[model samples]
Target chain A: MSGCDQCALAGVLPPAPTADPGRPRLIAIVGPPNSGKSTLFNRLTGLRQKVANYPGVTVEKRLGRARLEDGHEVALVDLPGIYSLSPRSEDEQVAHDVLAGTMPDFPRPDAVLLILDSTNLGRHLMLAAPILALGLPTMIVLNMADDLRKRGGEVDAESLTKQLGAPVVLASAAQDQGLEPVWRFLTECGAAPSPVDLPALQDVPRCHAWAARLGRHAAYQPPAPPIWTRRLDSILLHALWGPVIFCLVVVVVFQSIFSWARPLMNGVQWLIAWSGAWVGSLVPNTWARSLLVDGVWTGVGSVLVFLPQILLLFLFIGILEDSGYLARAALIADRTMARVGLQGKSFIPLLSAYACAVPAVLATRTIENQRDRIATILVAPFMTCAARLPVYTLIIAAFLPERPVLGPLLGTRAAAMLGLYALGFLAAFATARVLKSSILKSERTPFVLEMPPYRRPTLASLGLRLLDRAKIFLRRAGTVILAMAVVLWIVAHLPLSAGKVPPIERSLAGTLGRTVEPVIRPLGFNWKIGVGLITSLAAREVIVGTLGTIYGMEPDAKSRGLQAALRSDLTPGGAVALLVFFAFAMQCMSTIAVVRRETGSWKWPLVQFSYMTTLAWCGAFLANRIVTALA
Target chain B: MQANVIRRRAPASLAELRKGEQGILDRLDLPEDVSRRLMELGFVPGSPVVAALSAPGGDPRVFRVDGSEIALRHDTAVRLKLRPAASAAAN
Candidate 1:
């Protein structure tokens, strides 16, 4: 294609039909958040196809090959969850744009599957009619059928089909039921003709005419809630008790991170140390011993220490999301979020960023608005990630001496960890406000979200999600972080001289650090510290490992790693200065790459990096200067 | 409740209206804060509301008002005054 033609193609606009074509078979799935579009997508696709990104976009589109029972192959694409066809967020736009073919690149599906909740069919069909107006083949999937069983509700699918001018298949994607019937209908015949059964497109009594033609479709009744659920929800969403209950639940979740995961964390640490010792005994003076013990063991092993905690965190979050309590939590926070020009959905990504930003940025795919996604990305880096844990733990241990609290009832170590995490969060909230008003001045999309019903979380699925996260971390360690650490180690440890020249001073790292030392000196860091910051370009955790090796505190250095070495090696003020430096630093090159990919441009990533680096330098400098003066 | 009660039992709230149920809103009994917010969302007392989709559990009912679609808590939905069409009322 010519450049101009390519440009036009890239900006393809959605097609709006002026007249209705004979109703094509379009099945559209419409429901509230957590209503299981993704689960349904998985059922329909069933490991048949891969989830891939759109040609040039970070938004994931699931494509699968579906074979009809009669044996016709059909290509299926699962659109992102959307409240309506009217686009407010980037995610919603992708869905709307694809359906409308507003974008030249996105092809409109021949059939649309309108998924509805069996318990909430009344509200779900509002989006259905609009899709019907598109004059495409359509059917409605009444998802979450299992919920109705527990709640004492039943939908008359056959009667609803006659009333809707299309077939209604009651399926529970979570439990794998009624899926084939829906798929068979989609592949076989298209949507039924637009009947006079349902309401028309107008604002007035079209419902009356529609209902009259379609008898009994509206007469079905919802099952009553199970006693257990009723009792749970009473307190879960209670006006006065709900907030207290929710807070208690959150506290329990965090406490599990420190308490419940201790055994597993200890096991991981033991394994790392044992393996390191075994290798050290084998390779005596060889570089292999250093690589296995000091490099791999101390660097990557430290990260693995918290895997149990991370998994537990994901487990709790996944369950909360599956159970529909997340929506209630959002509803509770909605008023507060609205005040900040953010919506309830923003909380999901912000909270996820605490564990790490990679998946959290990807999770923004759920937020239908583009402006909102971009704003969320800019603020996500401020949330203290798991990688920062080791750094924070070391600093808090050294500077904030444990003290008795609550009249000696509380453990001081636990309190210190909590305080450090709190400080990171406070910084994040302040940064979010500043960035929301200044650099990222996008209009805040209104928070209009559907709160789906509660359901038991499937352990199989939750385990799979946790495994996926672990795999991602491992991949980063092996490729980005591992390579960066080795390269940094080589630069900082090469060609030692007997009092002739310093190892780092004559090496690449030292030269670069010296170049930047003048600029960074005001931040209370020497040339060696400046070099550590530069080498940490791969990830935040790399800074500590790099400093450990550079300061002769590597596992092989006859001293425990960096934190212990730092206490003896530097003045207390210098140690504090280093802690402050890591607090504000944007040292993760991988995070920067993901931000660029998500934003679809280099501008935002550069802005994020520059602002964060500048802040890190200033914060470190001020802390260092004040500490020295006080001493 | 009255002779002119539109549709089945004169849907006392928007939640009572089934999907595809279209009606001219009669009145709102919502508290002042909620009613103001509803109006901001284009669900003014007289504006037509077409019940769209009910969520999985069905408490927050999605409705289309003006050109926008929004979800409302089912309890809050019950306070929205609505008049069903004469024909559907006849059904």
Candidate 2:
């Protein structure tokens, strides 16, 4: 009755009932960024939520089914956190479009659950006011109440409810308090009406002023000055100390990605090898055994072996992102990045690309400028991702001797590895500069970022993120990479030859490799290397597997035999050329697919692929010539 | 009193303030969307702001305002008109 009374007072009619009575009511959870909206959604939906992307965009749409206290179910959609309805960024536009019921895939929500941070009541309300004016059955959730209370701040929910004409609930999503009231309110509230002809909607200043006033009426008490935050920021944001600490943190993360993952990677490798051998014995037919063992097990397993490193990388990224340290890193890196025609915001995505480019490409969504985002994506793959590690380690082990460089502190092989990483970054920087100045030229947008107060990242959330990333990686391996592996296997085994020559040398892959060999020979790559290069397009790591399969060796953890064969087969110059080629080539199909999806065009991905391949060839030729001259 | 208030030198841009200085934000001279965004993040007129820390190269600095720290580049910070606090001026 009070909801309807408020609707009538606002001169708006209540929304009509759903066309299907049996269908569950739709509730949308919306809030500003870092307001704990996702935490609340997780609590409400638990494992019931489904993650998907909006049609034609990379923006995620998360929907879940939540059961109310009365055994009734309602559909809850977690919209992306946006500051206001006037959307500037694509992420903001998607959130705005979904809430306006303009996105065809999603219908208008029957009710709205607007989450507001109690600690920053005024700013949150600036966003809340626009949603409330939309005239839906809105409930204001004052989240982080526990944190507010700790700082001697209080919010009068009843007074806020009276002032805003919407039901307000004080909840601490992290502490899991005050959630039951949300379900009760949603169930009790019927179809909410749309606010019609609201004067505040037309004027931006009036809306802000009105929200500020409502914030006062709510008895909102601002939290005490964050002493701990200030103290930490003093050291962390220091002109000299900040960059040093950021570099150290990056070193630790990258080091851990390799060192911590080694044992687990070996375990995965052992399992794959054991299974491949097991399958080889079980299958009687040579072709069937080869397909199962070499195609699926070796090919997909080689890529999957990098999962531990990938998961570790995501975990570190999750902690950095959740604790709000990445923004500080961005601020520190902004000046250096500007020289390359990128803002500090591109720093995290480029750094993440070192772990894997797929997620890094997706992470570019945070960049508001379309041209900047595309430019960042265009150069992301050049950063030596974990996928390239296998090839690098293989080539280094085969070519470079393990001689101590810094009196046992560092070795020649280790130095070579560092050089490869540096090369990737140098290439990325040069590519970004070229792309920004030419193809994706735009005036620099003003850099403005909220430095969120640091908090302890919740283990539960971190674990969930790790699990989600692992799921996505495994899914890609199962689908795209698996299909590619099978196709490559068929190509490598087709037109069965009855001669003493190996099938791989006589198959379609062999002919294709031979055809391309002349073009690549200048770079010191033979037809076998050419074949490896072609299969590497599926994934960079697959080159190692493809080479193993081509050379008639088992691709597994113990790739020593393959390494020995490579050492005998390749000159040092050829080996360096191969490593250089893998370092710059746009070889990952997943990266290309994600780029196409992110840029919403085939044109950019094609350009990205061609330019990168050309760069790789040129770089490899130069490296080969230099090494050959030195030798 | 009115004459004295009028005679006070115009407020300096936020970019000119050294670290540890405090100022009251007068107005933002950025584009519409950007200024509105800055205001929404508690850069409203008359709010007390302190230059907290400068990043390496000192082009962008973190400013503490309304219990939140915001990072702004020099280009963006120059658009912020701020009246230095009397105590900060004395310091």
**Alpha carbon deviation, residue A214, candidate 1 (Å):** 5.7
Native-referenced DockQ of model 2: 0.52
Candidate 1 residue lDDT tens string, A155-180: 67787776556667888888898788
- The regions of model 2 sitting more than 4 angstroms off are A1-17, A191-199, A239-241, A279-283, A362-372, A393-415, A441-444, A498-502, A552-574, A596-604, A624-631, B1-11, B83-91
Model 2 clash pairs are A15-A193
Worst 10 residues of 1 chain A by lDDT: A1-10
Best by lDDT: 2
| Complex DockQ per candidate | 0.10, 0.52
Measured by TM-score, the strongest candidate is 2
Give the count of colliding residue pairs in each prediction.
47, 1
TM-score of chain A considered alone, across all candidate predictions: 0.78, 0.89
**Model 2 chain A lowest lDDT segment of ten:** A190-199
Instruction: Report the TM-score of candidate 1, chain B only.
Output: 0.77
